[model samples]
Target: MAVGARLTPDVLELDPAAATDRIVAELRTIVGKTLRRRGAVLGISGGIDSSVTCALCARAFGPERVLGVLAPETDSETETLRLSHVVVSTFGVPYVVENITPILAAARCYERRDETVRELVPAFTSGWKLKVVLPDVVGNDLYRVLFLVVESPDGRQERHRLTAEQSLAIVAATNFKQRTRKMIEYYHADRLNYAVAGTPNRLEYDQGFFVKNGDGAADVKPIAHLYKTQVYRLAEYLGVPEEIRVRPPTTDTYSLPQSQEEFFFSLPYQKLDLCLYAHNHGLRAEAVADAVELSVADVERVFRDIEQKRRTTRSLHMSSRLVEPVAEIDLSDA
Candidate 1:
């Protein structure tokens, strides 16, 4: 996928009020059609996406019928839980916290100490050169340090060596937390006879910055169509807590709560979106920079990142052979 394909500003320029109206209408239709006999279940992540989703759900189906699940892992921040509560209270919805820490801990302990590393080595070594392995490891560690320092002012350097096995184990453990939350979401949604509502925005979705089956699992997405800025607008409209709206967005996966911009790329969402828009319209990198009021080098860098992400997304979707084609079936004959 070229940067010029999906980053058009025209496509990104959506009318906020119309979009909200459309979202609310579509959500109501989805709930009416899918959960007419029961109700709707939404995994509330306490982020803008989920907050906006909860507000829309409350407006569409009423708070009583919309159940909010706070599926936090052991490492999830206290803020996540607090924000989840704020959303529930604001919407006056029934909420529950199903801590998956026990499940994750059990899963981690169930496997042998080196199991994950043993499994990952083959995949890692397949295309990796033996000579570059140590360097790659060092580079990753350095990047982690930089990330930590940026997110946490008090982060200290603690030299710790890791075997390849240990490194892989750490990676797997972090990934498990995300997958476990999704499992809980699925199970609870089924048990409660409600739809699983995914909380991903257009920016993340377009960037393909989500775990496919993990946080991406949802039956209905109330905020998927909105961009980050647009979500903020909706959040304000819905009276989301001031802290939540103002605080930087983070995944809170690591020890430090890293902002999405810091982890992804340093480019602000508005500028990134504008650059993307120019690029998607077949503008050259220099032209995009000029159009978006960014440096030429910055534009080039963002364009490259966008291109890379598009490729990764395409590879993931195509590899799974899960690209559902648009159907143009006609019922006139019937």
Candidate 2:
């Protein structure tokens, strides 16, 4: 930025071609030279982040060395499988489909989650669908809280405020899905001696949106520094499938369709990106209000929420504590 340059949405833009080359080069160094791994392995979710990651990995370590794993479970949307296939096929990468439903079922993931849901809505049963959502932070001044939504067999729906214990129980059970998928990813990586790639964008990475030791576990994350909006830019440059580029961001963890905004983030991704940028740059809420098309107060609310999430999720980024420091050897080529 130059002196007196305006701060608008343009500030977040970057040269997609340059970014692609830089990321591919860096991934080569990290995955090949530093990690000393044969290639890369990653789970493709058919989402923008994962799709872009697959494309970058293919460029970094040819399509033969890049393996895309499609791990779908019972609750996953029908399109998840199709879109995941589209991503791998577009990149011309060899992939294996790992159905994780049996693993989750063996762990009683659904059983525990349903038991918790039934505590709130007794009618929630085998034929019911369930999802958890947070209130609109920018549109409402109320405290941030989780609400449980369940649809009965005949299409009747109901929403209820979740008790603290119930929320923890539900989340704990659902976390099995992510951790289970990560286990499968590592299994293939270990067998092939490949590095595991993580696909969290700047928003999810910075805001602690991933499950620890689950989706958060990775050998290298190529897009952790790119915003969701910027990820879209790189997607186009990488020639990611058009269908994935146009698809809305989703959680895909719940039975019912759920947008990332309703599940966690306070605003739509584009607006949230601008607000996050302004917040990171120390720009006043009033300064970015018009750019993000939100009131100053709303921007302030979002800023507060950002900080709150950071404070709460700080532990998620930590390593195991030691009684004292221990020197470790470096094995990478100099």
Against the true structure, whose lDDT is highest? 2
Give per-residue CA lDDT, model 1, range 278-312, as digits (tens). Answer: 65667777655554566666677677767767886
TM-score for each candidate, following the candidate numbering: 0.73, 0.96
Clashes of 1: 3
Residue pairs in steric clash, candidate 1? 4-280, 9-277, 196-219
Q: Which ten residues in a row are the worst by lDDT in model 2?
A: 325-334
In candidate 2, the residue pairs with backbone N, CA or C atoms under 3 Å apart (3 or more residues apart, or in different chains) clash, namely none
RMSD of 1: 8.0
Q: Which residue ranges in model 2 land beyond 4 Å of their true spot?
A: 1-6, 328-334
Candidate 2 has a TM-score of 0.96
Point out where model 1 deviates above 4 Å: 1-15, 34-37, 109-155, 158-169, 286-293, 315-334
RMSD of each: 8.0, 1.8
Tell me the tens digit of each residue's lDDT in model 2 across 1-334. Answer: 4443445888889999899999999999988888899999999999999999999999999999999999999999999999999999899999999999999999999999999898888777778998999999976777777999999889888999998899889999999999999999999999999999999999999999999999999999999999999999999988987889999999999998999999999699999998889889878888788888888899999999999999989988886777866668333334
